[model samples]
Target: MDGVDKERVQKIVYEMSKGSKYFENEKRKEATINQKIEDLRAQCVLLTDEQISFYQTVADKRIIDLEASRDLSKTWLHSDMDAFYAAVETLENPSLKGKPLAVGSMSMLCTANYEARKFGVRAAMPGFIARKLCPDLIVVPPNFQKYTYYSELTRKVFSNYDADFIATSLDEAYVNITDICNDKSVSSEQIASELRNTIYEQTGLTCSVGVAPNRLLAKVCSDINKPNGQFILPNDYKAIMTFISSLPIRKVGGIGKVTEHLLRDVLGINTCEQMLQKSAYLCALFSEHSTDFFLSIGLGLGGTDTPQHKLRKSMSCERTFSATEDESALFQKLADIAEALSNDMHEEGLCGRTLTLKLKTSSFEVRTRATSLQTYIHSKEDILAHASKLLKAELPLSLRLMGLRMSQFYDVKPGRHDPMQKTLKNFIIKDASQSTSCSSYSSDQHLRNGANIDPSAAEESCLSKFESGHLMAVCEPEDYQQSNQIAPVKVCRPGNDASGIKDNADECVPQVHADNEGRSNPEESLTNQNGKMLWWIDDYICSVCGAELPQCFIEERQEHSDYHLAEMLQKEESLNNRRGLLQRERPVVSLVGKISPVGDVARKKQKTSKGKFIPIDAFFNRYKKD
Candidate 1:
């Protein structure tokens, strides 16, 4: 798109894809976007002078609040590999250099080389369609293993700059070089140049680097001078504002084609500056979440901190969203994460002496602080007490994510390998984990079905045939939190609105009537249930997992309990497998050596002789001597 004839390529793409399903789907999506834009436009017309004034006031107030939280101390660099997959392919096959090349099959293309891109045969285009755009284009199958090898090579270079750099993908990463710049007394430009040169030297793959005060602008800057180039936006308010004033809205990361159409067609917002000029319209037409991001973009603001943690043999829970410096909100989120972590630890009968608190700044600088206590703790109250102290020490810090990791197990003695090894193998907690490193990381769940909300979305019916079961703590019958009042349970039916299977809901628990045409949104059902939903849940929590499950659903709770037990058993079995392998060689080295199964080993080793049963090893040694 940068240099190619856009109209010609559009015609070629259309000719090649006109009748295809992909084309039709794209058309459908375009129509939907257009319809949504029209709806927004209509709403805009309906807004009176007073309404516009009110929205503008709200927007201005939010802008002031958001600006107060900005941190310009960190210099964020977004390093992007130039045509990563294609470049890797070319590096491996020198003959492919200077030729139009693509890394993918006829079905889809991951990326295209610079030469291919000039012909408008770009990434995400179908390979067959790309061929039409540029008949000379050479398509190749992707080799991820080779790509990963080179990616690691580049990340090794990255570790030198910032060991905690966040690798968003194999070819791109956001690194906060604030400390290095201060320590080395160097400019941000020099660091970006060094990184680019070092990566080129090591892997024969050139990269583009963008240096700015925050991640968003850095990312935009990286794309400006593409193909083995670098761009640095000055870390000054005037410079940042000037740079983004006329920048295209489409250049922003989260603004896709649909959003591009919406803004340009509806609000006449073609640039970041225009977005600010029309903030009132944005606030009026879109959700607060969407408007907040738009306002931030207009002001040249973005997340400077997001926590990237390295979870070891520990239990942790965290969430990521828009960054904020709110004290009460931070404490509340911290408490929630801690509570979830507590439940996970208790499920596995674990307690730790050390608690690590993780905080990522809006600029993505991770600050981890820790506290060690003499006594091990697993309860939510104790975890929160220690973690809150650690968080308080880092007060007035703007954070996008917070996590609590409980480590340094109480049962793990320093010198004891067996217990530690067993614990490592057996107690691999499946709790939510989050981490950040200088290199790329892999993989980043809960099932609460049967939500009680939205009467229109649900169909209610009575389960007259249903027979009630004694269901207090049905998840694990022995694990009940004893109380005089029996709390109700919730039964969840998958692929439907969580059809409440609550037994004795003061009546028959409502069954969501099966609607053949009704669409189900599982994600919507899983969102934070509001205050209204908690009216009947009372003070009760699920006995088995210690999570709040509200009023009961017995059959589903049993399923959850079964799943929990099965997971525990699987971990125990894995530990046994490891110990079994270790024990196999132990008896050969010394008969007196410890065996894993004492009773079974005794049965196998003991044998009756003439009078008394002699030790097996001693008896065998005497025969060999004879």
Candidate 2:
């Protein structure tokens, strides 16, 4: 019996023998005590506290003993689908069976079915490489929405057995059945079998479970016979050590290529037990953390204070090459890494300003360097530029491992409906598009979908889950047609004439009164009235129906300069509306844009720059009409 079960048995006895029941009738009480003892003995193998604790002792000892002799056992269960995505695809499309298959994108593979594994196709492998291995392999894109639904169902199945059942990831979990089966009655083998059977019945998917004294052994044991099988770690330490020591160093936590080489080549330590033996040496070789790591493994101390479910602070993607060192090859690999990292960011609606580069040398010198940009960048070019710069600055060194980490996240703000800020953001967008603007432009312009633009493929998957927004594939040319076709109304620029008769231009720029009276210029006010009137004319509504317009008008613009002024206003309104919508629609990605009130100091700056700062009156006054 385990520690959990032993406590339960003692508690049951104390509760039953404590008081009045035994004293009420000595003859009856003696029989009841004997029966209770027999019952406890019967459940000793699989006993847990959750089992019924009989407060009222029974009178029949022989019957209780007979019940105890008829042994009842409990089995631990773990069920996971084999190559969950590819398998699901195979199940639906029968033609996919017998043929190698994988689930991922054109860039990389997420997971491969067993058939694909035989041909050296594996998870995270580049699709091109996988295709070379198995030319006929069918590649299916990931259906994350369906995967999430299935994950929730799997969690529900685990909870049905034990609310305390711990899920490690999407497809893995551990259950402590010691409390469920009581101390003496149930066997671990029995518990394992029933749980597997229950999961199959509920989910129609088979899984493998491992029964052990603790979770550490259970995880390792479970992987031994996968795809509907179970294994148990017995009551022995030396045998367990031998089993663990024979495995690769990668099996041990924190034992990457660098650490593994340090242990095997430098320290002459290879298996778990060998590494465990040299814990002190490892501590000195690496740091305090490395020492604690090996020591914990040595003692089979797996569970830590770390909670099972916590938000991932950082996400990284990396790859190891078949060859030792090539800078050009590393560049291509870096591009792939950047694409994957950015795609994940877009999916999670996250933006990270910090980029980290990880490298491993042939001599196994692990080096890492990171730099944080002024703004979050999600483009492949930007990611590669930064990562490559770090590598170049730190290189002329051999390489074995390379990784990219996107972290130091900033939340994406929702769309706003502010007119002035919206107009300003558009001007910035125009500035950014004219040049190779970094991610800051995308961040400032509120053009988040710019990061999702895939130049290679015309058919891109656009998913806009928000009610007000859309997942528009830029390739869908028709979606932008109507807005793009509507040319901007002509607004004449105030050009200078050689004659110096600039009455029309000068009249528009109304001179302030010499007395500095409160009387504002009527002609200046005429432009203001025209703007207010024109704002009502072309502001973001159907001129005919007056219904609120869709966002497409602001996004799609004609190249003609005639409509520049009105077009700018329309775009500004659209940006503001989009910004407002983004903020309220999805607060998770909200990057809060504060509005600072313009004071006399700001006016002076605007005046000197000739409205470069875009003061309200100059913008509306100068560009309101033709």
After superposition of all CA atoms, the RMSD between model 1 and the true structure is 26.0
Q: How displaced is residue 244 in candidate 1, in Å? A: 1.2
Write one digit per residue (lDDT tens) for candidate 2, span 273-354: 6655554344434455555556545544454122343334577998866535677877788789988987765444344668
Show where candidate 1 strays beyond 4 Å: 1-3, 309-566, 569-626
How many residue pairs collide in each prediction? Answer: 21, 46
Question: Which candidate's TM-score is highest?
Answer: 1
Q: What C-alpha lDDT values do all the predictions have?
A: 0.64, 0.49
Model 2: which ten-residue window has the lowest total lDDT?
521-530
Q: How accurate locally is residue 322 in candidate 1, as Cα lDDT from 0 to 100?
A: 69
